[model samples]
Target chain A: MAIVTPGKRPGERVANSKVLGKRFTRAKKVGHASLMLTSLVDMFSIIVIFLLMNFSANGEILYMTKDIKLPSAQHGGQLERAPVISVSADSVTFDGKQIATTEDLQKGDVLNVPELEDVLREERRRYEQIHVNDPEHPFKGLVNVQADRKIPFKVIKRVMFSCNQSGFGNISFAALAKTAGEGKPLAAN
Target chain B: MAGAAAQPAGKGGKKALDAELNLVPFIDLLSCCIAFLLITAVWTQIAGLQVASSGGPPDQQQKLENTIDVKLMLTDKGYALTMAGANIDIPKISRDGAQNFDRKTLSEKLKTLKASLPEQGSITVQPEDAVAYEDLVNAVDTCMGEQLRNVTVAPMN
Candidate 1:
């Protein structure tokens, strides 16, 4: 048997009654905020995944040439944007400046090696500033050569030698997407 | 009186505690990423080239009325002629015959084929794997040398 307090009955205590309605209950306002945050986390995760997939897929679509034929290379190299030098059968041009031709580079022809080397060096400096400061940037040292099929290997060798002297090592050749019909032999101009 | 006192205590503290972990922000983020991925996946598959090798059957619609299938196999010596998979030996051209990429003979062969072709002449050059690059280049050059421009390089199957 338990003894009851003589001061007040447990169910009829006046102190509990006095404090009852005075205390305030906080409202469930966080409902909207929780829903908002849940959506945010979901959105960020999907973005991270999408970015990862996109960076990889970008590798294939990046280096395809629509207009020129690329010489087959024995050395496999990654395709990246490089300083483009377009060589037609008749002449060689760097950034639209016609530098030389078969006639201009023949034996006893005065070839401007120093001038060619200077231009390549300028390109290298420009590219380095744009692509090297940030570690994540992928456009490192690369040079794209768009040489015509008929351009003699001797002419290309000279250009390549100049490129090496300019301290730019990476190289890529541009080729036309194979098509039906007798493909045009690279013009010899 | 006792029930009235306990009611406010039970409701007041619990409401505030339930408000802490809001999920609204997280759901907003997920909606954006899903939309981005959907767009990218659709963009991945666009224009691409289809490559076909020579030695395969010519296109049915492109074939002339009576097409002659001349199979020229690149040998150590020179070109050997075949038709419908059977070898046809020409005189003075032995298995160990002239190994030089004889420009004269090659140009003559191309000229004959060019004359016999229907409106458009098509010759397929199938070179053996062991043939030197120079010889292959020479063979192609000779075909073109005779002004037989419609040619395709087909590897032997």
Candidate 2:
């Protein structure tokens, strides 16, 4: 058996004295701003899930520029740590160093780039000396080329020619990774 | 950061009991996680398409002999696939005269070529001076998707 007593609810309750009533009345609307954490938590959780999906452990990703917009590809391998040669409409740079100008390369009929070859040769030598005995990370002769999508193939041909000349025979073109099913499926015979 | 709420216990109740898991620390941790992931997230996955020789030291690439030289040539007009002294032209089909070569036809031709030469997995891409880099990349991508992994880019003479 329980005994019930008549009590004042929150709405029906009155302040004890004049000062208390004034204080309560003033604090009611001032401190009543409650945060809607449900929606905030929901949005943060969604963003966290999306970011986790796109997170990559490969820290040394390509240092891309606004000038070079890479082409998208469906089939490709993960980028290896190699010397990158970025070619834009204005100039050709290797490992952030300006090796040659695009206009000069286009004007000249020579396929081989002497300046770029020198730099790559030095890099290849250094790599060989460092990894001579270590079989784990042998010299793979890999190099990355980041070029603009709209640039002419003539500039790329020279860059590749120079890369091959400098013993970096394995040339990998940096491309934006695209989903597989975005394009129509073509049979691989 | 945890406490049980006092509620009337009943065998049959009008409202279903719902436990509100409102933790300030949990929200704080979630915010931290979201910040960390957002800061370190790689929005666009930049990958690599290997399109050249395994030859190293002196640059004298081995001539791919005893194999049909499957060369896909990209020109200003269209794409021309050359194999063993024969040229199969696959014209670009676009209303605005853009470089839109028929990928399906090219795939069929490559399938036929691959069936004939199963051992040869390498291809040489020859691009003209006026050809765009994106077009060349797309051509190489198609070849690689068709299991021709070893693609060597060469300047068209």
Scoring each candidate complex against the real one, what DockQ results? 0.04, 0.43
- Candidate 1 lDDT over A1-189, as tens digits, reads 799656434454543566752243234565443245556576677676866565444333333333333433211223354566666656667776867764555444322356667899898787768777677865434566665454544455456556656764444444333322334332210
Best by DockQ: 2
Query: Retained native contacts per candidate, as fractions?
Result: 0.04, 0.74
Misplaced by over 4 Å in model 2 are A1-32, A36-39, A181-189, B1-22, B53-67
lDDT of 2 at A118: 97
Q: A1-189 in candidate 2: lDDT tens per residue?
A: 677455532333456555445544533457578888888888888988888888888865577789889988888889988999999998899899999999898886888899999999999999989889999998778899989998898888888888888878888888888878765443311
lDDT (10s digit) by residue, model 1, range B22-135: 344445555655665555553322111111123222451265655566655676555766645756432224224443544455556556666766453445667654554334
- For model 1, the superposed segments whose C-alpha errors exceed 4 Å read A1-78, A108-112, A177-189, B1-157
The second chain of candidate 1 has a TM-score of 0.47
Model 1 quality (TM-score)? 0.33
Chain A only, candidate 2, TM-score: 0.74
- DockQ of candidate 2, scored on C-alphas against the true complex (2 decimals): 0.43
lDDT of 1 at B137: 44
